[model samples]
Target: MLIGDVARHSGVSTRMLRHYDALGLVRPTGRTVGGYREYSAEDVRRIFHVESLRSLGLTLKQIGRALEDPDFTPSALVGDLIRWTEERLEREQELLERLRAVDASAPTGWQDVLRIVELMQGLDSTSAARRQQAVLTRPEGVPVPAELLAAAVLAESDPLVAGALRWALARSGGDGVAALTAGARSEDVDVRRRAVLAIAGTAEAPGAAAVLADALGDPDPTVRGHAALASGRRGVTAAVPVLVGMVVEGSHDVEAAEILGTLSQDPGCAERILAALTGELAAPTADSATRIRLTQALVELSGDTGREALRRLARDDDRAVALVASAFVAVLDERSPEVPGAEVP
Candidate 1:
């Protein structure tokens, strides 16, 4: 076939076919009667092969080697192509995210757009100080949208920067809550933990309570523990069981115990907290330290149930527990006549 015919039949532009010939990638070996360059069937086949490999993100150089180099294996080259494609996709996704954030901010002019972009760059900076500065900007400054801060906080690894991001997010008037709720469902454990911590700081925001309730059931104990403490402080009765469990595990047990004490303000809640604590106290895993922490927690409780439990522990088989409990019982009796139980918040 003539080159023009090959171009017409194969749908390759004649210009590209000439380029391929010059590169020795697909030179037609046959000559027409007019002595013009002509494509043989095999040459046409090679042209189609190059196009096929090119569609798989192969560079022209790589495709040339794939077709001409007999020893060239495809596995490593295909893996490279995959990696390159993945990197490209990641960059595109980041660009898209930036665009979405800018659009969400609803910039009214180029200056507003520039300010939003600057804040985003600051938040994404390698220096934690820069990121924190972005978050700590005064409200009258860049006017960065809440979603941007929410995204930054979810991914922030530096404790100082993360705290600042959370602090900024808390004052977004609940604008950050939706992003935070999605973050709470992240597969990354650290991301979920950060999301829960942010939610805790923003608990006064609308929808914060429901998200906190959901986080209480998270498989990561740290996530669940914070959720429990936050929710317990919010007076959600659901946090009672986990707060008691925190006392047993000694993970933030003091805070957990204190929150438990606060939750005990409800007369019915007092009985529940008392029962859960006493139940753990009776468990085989209740070590002396566990019992003592639980004891101090019991003392923080409001009703006579705490004092009553202390009186029983005064005779605990563990000598140390008995002494501590006996001492606490005496203190409780002395303070009991002097002050009434704390009023429920």
Candidate 2:
């Protein structure tokens, strides 16, 4: 076949076929009487082979080595191609995400588009300071997409940066709640923990309280603790059980107790609080340390029920428990001058 016929048959352009010949990638392998380049069947086959390799993102130089290097093995080259393709895909995905964020913002002009792009780049920066600044300085009215913020919050390992991201998410008015809620369900414990914390920070958002209430049941104690603390502060009665449990477990028990004390302002909650503490105090399996923490937690409760509980605990058989409880009872008695006759059991 002549060059024209070869081009027509192979669908490889004539210019490209000539370029391939010049590079000695697929020489004609014959010359016609008129001296025009002529291709044998093998030459056409080589052209198709080059096109096939190009489809795999192989550069012309790489293709040449693949075709002509007798010692070349595909293992290393294929691995390199895979890496390059993956890198390209990641870049493309990132670009797509940025475009989506811009579109979501409904940018008014090129400047808004540029600002969003800059903010995204800053958020993804390796420097924690840059990421923090990105969140701290997020321009108002140019909303950063909640999904992006939630993903960053979940992955951020720096405490300062993570805190700022959480604040930013909260400022976005619970827009990130759905994303953070998804994060709360992540299999990664750290991710779940972060999700709950972010959700708690956003508790002021319209639906954030409900999301936190849902998070209260997370299996991860850390997640549950955060959710309980936030929800308890928000007066979500659903967190009562978990807050009581934290006191018994001695996990952030101090904060839990404080929040529980606030929750106890409700007469019904006070009864439940006292009952939960009394039950934990009487549990034979309660470790000495756990019992001590639970006893101390009672001091944070309001009303005489807690003081009376402390007084009863003061006479318990466990010397250490009795000593701590006795001290707290004395303190409570001294603070309430009206109880002049109050004494440790």
lDDT of 1 by residue, 1-345 (tens): 888999998899999999998888889997878888889899999999999998999988888998878999999988988999999999999999999888987778898888888888888789998888876774464456688888888888999998888877766553787888899999999999999988888787789899999998999999998799889888898999999989999999999888888888899889989999999999997899999989888998975669877877887899888888888877877776623553211
For model 1, state the Cα shift of residue 343 in Å: 26
- Model 1 scores worst on lDDT over the 10 consecutive residues at 336-345
The TM-scores of all predictions, comma-separated, are 0.86, 0.88
**Which pairs clash (backbone N, Cα, C closer than 3 Å) in model 2?**
none
lDDT of 2: 0.86
Prediction 1 global C-alpha lDDT: 0.86
Candidate 1 global TM-score: 0.86
Instruction: Please list the residue runs of candidate 2 whose C-alpha ends up more than 4 Å from where it truly belongs after superposition.
Output: 139-141, 284-288, 330-344
| Model 2 per-residue lDDT tens digits across residues 1-345 | 999999999899999998998988899999989999999999889999999999988988899998899998999988998999899999999888878888877788998888888988998899999899988987778767788788889999999999998878777653788888788878899998998898888777767787787788888888889999998998887898899899888789889989988888888888898899889889989988989988988888877659888888899889999999999988887787535566647
Instruction: Return the clash pairs for model 1, or none.
Output: none
